[model samples]
Structures are given as structure tokens and as C-alpha cells.
Target: MQKGKVLSLEDRIPKIKEHRRRKANRRLIFLLTLFFLLIACVVYIQSPLSQINQIVVYGNDLVTTKDILSVSSLKKGENIWKINKEQAKKNLMAIPEVKKAEVRMEFPNNIVINIKEYSPIAQIVSEKEFLPVLENGTILNKSTLLADAPLLINFKTGTYLEELVAQLKEFPSEILNAVSEIHYDPKETDKYHIYLFMNDGFEISATIPTLAAKMIHYPSIASQLDSKVKGVINLEVGSFFKAYDEEEEKSEGEEER
Candidate 1:
């Protein structure tokens, strides 16, 4: 083998320095990448873009959207991180009309609020004032002949109005639809003497306790009504009908020999 030449210190030193410089450049690049990542994380935590950007509402009719938002502590542009969904829901439920409230958070930027409101079933007339009564027997806001909803007459002596209202609420929707007005006359010994005016101008005599049942069969009874006979359909007793007129009574008396 040929003898190898000895390396000079100058050549060896230059090569070593170049290697060290490359390693240092790599380390600097890594450090800069790590710093930027940390900054990005911090910005994500603090920026509004990461918070709730929208509030959506639903299932409300009478209570306006603005009123609902005003009552709630939640505000648009508020940081979602600070929102207490439970607390907000409780606040919404405190409103009398609100039957239920649901709150949810959507990823990246949204809050949704769902609300359900109570609907009135009938109106109870008291002392010439009409009070809207809900299905649960709860008295709602006072209303004035807004729609043609049927009126519920109160005839029970010493009975609570709320109880009567509850009873009316349980009536089938079909029966309720046919009724236009109800009149209470407690002096009529037969509590069953409650009068009902049909939407079709026919009058019915029924009692409070069995009114709902009779109304269910009213359509069939109404079908049998003679076109010329337009007086009263008395259903106080089971399935019995009577059509009487004062003029007919006078004519019959004259015809008696």
C-alpha cells in the first residue's frame, strides 16, 4: 500500500466548524417552530373567533325574541368559555309563559336556545272579564274575544274555578270544536240544565259533569234534527230528545174537543 498523506490542522478545523454550523441552524429552526406553535395556542384561547358567535332561538310565539334575550344573561359576542348553560336555562324557565328551556353549545362558534311556551285551551268568563286558561288549569294572560274559541260556563256551587277549567281542558278536541258558548244558571235545580250554543246556531241542554260525553255524541244527535224544528235538544237524560214549542202547545189546546 502507498503511504497516506497526514491531514493538516487547517483542513480538519474547517470541516469540523462547518458540521457544527449546520447543527446550530437546525436547532434554531426547531426553536422558532416551537415558539410559533405556543403563540398560536394562546391566540386560539383568547380570540372571540373561538367563542360563541351566534344565539338561535325557537318555539316561541307570544314572547318576542328580544324579550327572551333581554331576560337571559347571555349576550352576543360574549366568551363561550364563561357561559353557564344551566344558569341561563334556569333564568329562562323563570318566565311564566316558558314551559321548558334548552341550551346547547356548538363547536367553534354558536349557542342555541330552544324554548316551549304554554298554550291556552279555553277562556273562563268571570265578572264580565275573560281569563285565558291553559290545559294545566293555570290561569294565563287575560284576553278579549280575540278568536272564536268557545267559552266555558261555571255552574258548580262552592267549586273552584280552577277545577272547572281543568275539566274543560280534558274535553276531546272534536267536542270542543263544536261548542261556541256555555251559560251557567246555578238556580236550575238540575245542574244538567247548562245550555250550550253550537257553532251552527243549535242549542243543547246538558249538565256540567256529563257534558263532555254528551258532546262526543252531539254530531249524531244533530243529524236527526228536523229542519223545521229549531228549538232545543235536551240531553240531560241519557239519549232522550224533546222538541217543544209554545205555539204548538197553544194550537194543541185549541184542538182539544
Candidate 2:
């Protein structure tokens, strides 16, 4: 058999050296990449780029953006990553007018706060101005009259006012929207008597107990009435319409005499 040729030390030495050099080069490249990445992360964290730049507020009407931001405890220079969204929302919701609140970080350096404020359902007549009443029955003297909200005439701060708010909350939005004013006019037989003035030029006489349930069908009932006639809707008993015509009432008065 032919003897195997032995590789010269000079030749094998170069091959081993080249393999080691390549391995070292690869290791060096990996280390440098890792080192640069670590430095970049440190720089990013220390830089203002990681901090909040702007606060964007939405869905607010009663509570202003500044008020929301104040309660959120979020500042422009603070780190966005450090903010607790849940806690921020909780703080915003603690406000009397805020119904719901959501806080979100719009990456890099922005905070998005979306808030839903409680709309005033009705107002209590004060000495000269009307005090806004929320659905939860908290009165706000600072709040002005909302054009669409009904005025609560002859209403005082009591359970009746709270009950009024609770009942108003259940009404369909359109039915409630149609109302312009409500007057508390209690009779001897029914202490819950109320006179509601509709924006459509009709007066509705109803009680607090059945206000929401009965008013739900108001639009349907209004469709059946003559649009030209101004009348008082009596929901105190079975729903009925008595025309406010002077001649008719006079005729009835004469008959009673």
C-alpha cells in the first residue's frame, strides 16, 4: 500500500491560524454589536426622546383638557413608560363630571386621554341661575344651562330631585331631548304631579313614578296628534290629550256651572 503523505508543519500551521483568525473575527463582530446595542439603549433611556412631548385630549365637553391633564398626574417632561394608564384613568373618573376615562400612550412621546363627561339631564332653579344636575344627582353650580336640557322649576334639593334624575336617565334620548322645561306642580291627590313643556309646543302632565316608561311611547303618541293643535298631554292617568282651545274649556266650564 502507498504510504499517506504527511502535511508539512509549515502548511498545517497556516491553515490552523486562518481558522482561529476567522473565529476571532466573528467573536469580535458579535461583541461589538452587543456593546453598541447596550450603549444605544442607555442613551435612549437618558434622552428626552423617551419623555412625553404632548398630551392629546378627546371626548371632553364639561371637563376641559387642562383639568383632565391636571388630574392625570402626567407631565410633559415625565417618562411615558413610567405612566400607569389605569391609575390615570381612575383619577380622571374621580371628577364629578367625568363619566368615563381612558388613557393611552401613543408611542415615542405622546399621551392620548379620551374622556366622556356626564351630560346634564336637568337643572334645578336657584335664586337667579339654574344649577346643573347630573344623572348621579350631583349638582354643579358652576355649570351653565345646556340648551337641550330641561329646566326643573319649583324643584328643591331632595329625594324627589334625585328620583327625577334617575327617571330621566331611563328615557330614550330623543324623548328627553324633546323636553324643554319641567315644573313640579303637585295636587292634593298626587304629590308627584309635574308639568313638562315640550319643545314642540305641547305641554305634558305626568308623575315622577311612570315618567320614563310612559314617556318612551311619547313620540309614537305625538305622531297621532294634530300638529296644528296646541294641547296638554295627560299621562297622570291613561294617556290622553285635552286640547288647550279656549272655547272647549269654556264650554266645559259652563256645563259644570
Candidate 3:
């Protein structure tokens, strides 16, 4: 034979049927997927897991959970999926005390909010009340007396106060707690001059600019001193010690005697 005959209809029918079958299979799979997705959507919309039934707050001391909830506007029965975490966090950070806020969704009707509050660095004595100063140089009007926190006297809200807050923020808890008060004792040449009266009866004279760097060694300096003796630890430019004036010392001794 020189050439093959044309294929009959019977042979072509099977190929056509096979192509249609593949198309039908693809359509069926797509329809099945779409149906399942629709069902899933409906179920998720109605399920209790989608609703926020419980709200747990952590790491909040100064900022109350009620305040956080109020700012976030988070309420029970609201859809968990609808809660804007970033927006809630932004609202939380709007409060001066809240440093960091993390909002997370726990499945099965639970929402968790974690808050990190800025610890008060120092307190500015206003009349008899103490205004808490944050690390970011923010002054909070809430009045609370913490014996551990240092009282800042004659320090106005300005660059000096900011520097003092920054310096106090870097100090160790023990070292900071040891300080009882910080008095702004400006000198003729140095307006930033300050004096710190420690709870242990020692005093520190430091300038604003060099306070943090030099004051870091306060603990070390305190350790080397006579615990029973009260004197001034000068950290301005250079570290030195100045005992009280002989006259005042004699007067103090006479009173004690």
C-alpha cells in the first residue's frame, strides 16, 4: 500500500470522548473546590471560634487592662478576624505609659493583648505630689510616691529634665533606687549642675551632659566609700569626694552628741 486510508468515525469518536471526559473532570474539580470554599466561608462566619469570647492582657502594670480595652475598642462577641491588630497596637501606644503593645488572636474565641509599659525613670516634685517622668521625656500627671524612685527638685521640663530622664533610664535599678532626690543646683559656669541626695546618706554632684556616663560608676564609687561617712561624690568633669564643711560637720556632731 502506498498510503494509509482516512480514519473512520468510530476511531475518532473515542478520542473526542476522551477529550470531553478530561474537560468534564476539570470542571467537576473546580466546582467541588468552589463548593467547599463556600461551605467553609459560611461555617467560619457562624462558628463560635470566629467570635472573641475571652480577652487576656499581660505585662500591664501602670496601664490597666480596662484602659487598653477602651482604647482598642475590643469587645466580646466581635469577630476575631475583624480585629485590627496594628490599629489596636497604635491605640495602645497612644497612652504615654504603654511602650509596646502586641495584639494576638488565639483560636477558639480568645484574644490576647501583651503590653510593655515604660517604667518611670524619675519623679518631679510638684508641690507635695510627684509627677512621673518617662524615659522618652514624657511627664505623666498621675501622682504616685515610690520610695525607690528619685525625687527631682527645681528641675523644669526642658532639655535638662530630658537629659536627667535619659541618664536615670540608663541607671541600674539598685543605683537608681539608692538616690532619694535630685536637686538642680546650677553653678555660675554650669547651668546643668545637679545634686543627688542618696538614701544611704551620700550625695552626688553631677552635670547634665556627663551624668549618665559618669554616674554609671556610682555603685562602684559608693562601694569604695565609708558607709558610715556621709560626703559628696562629685562626678562633674572628674570624680572626686568632698566631705561636708568642717563647721557644718562640727555642728552635726554636736547635735548628734
- Highest-scoring model, lDDT: 2
TM-score, candidate 1, is: 0.67
Q: List pairs with backbone clashes in candidate 3.
A: none
Model 3 error, position 107 (Å): 0.4
Measured by TM-score, how close is model 2 to the native structure? 0.81
**Predicted candidate 3 versus true structure: per-residue lDDT over 202-244, tens digit per residue:** 8888898888788789888988988877788889988988777
Alpha-carbon lDDT, every model: 0.75, 0.90, 0.87
Cα lDDT of model 1 by residue, 38-91, tens digit: 999789878977677889998987578998887778888888888999999999
Query: 1-257, model 2: which lDDT tens digit per residue?
Result: 99999999998999999999999999999999999999998998899989999999999887778888999999998987888999998999899999888899887789999888888888888887878898889898674867878999999889788888999999988889999999999999988899999999999999999999899989988999999998899998799998889648889999999
Best-to-worst order by TM-score is 2, 3, 1
- In order of appearance, the predictions have TM-scores of 0.67, 0.81, 0.79
Quote the positional error of residue 200 for candidate 3 in Å: 1.8
Residue 209 of model 1: what lDDT? 76
Which residue pairs clash within candidate 2?
Answer: none
- For model 3 the TM-score comes to 0.79
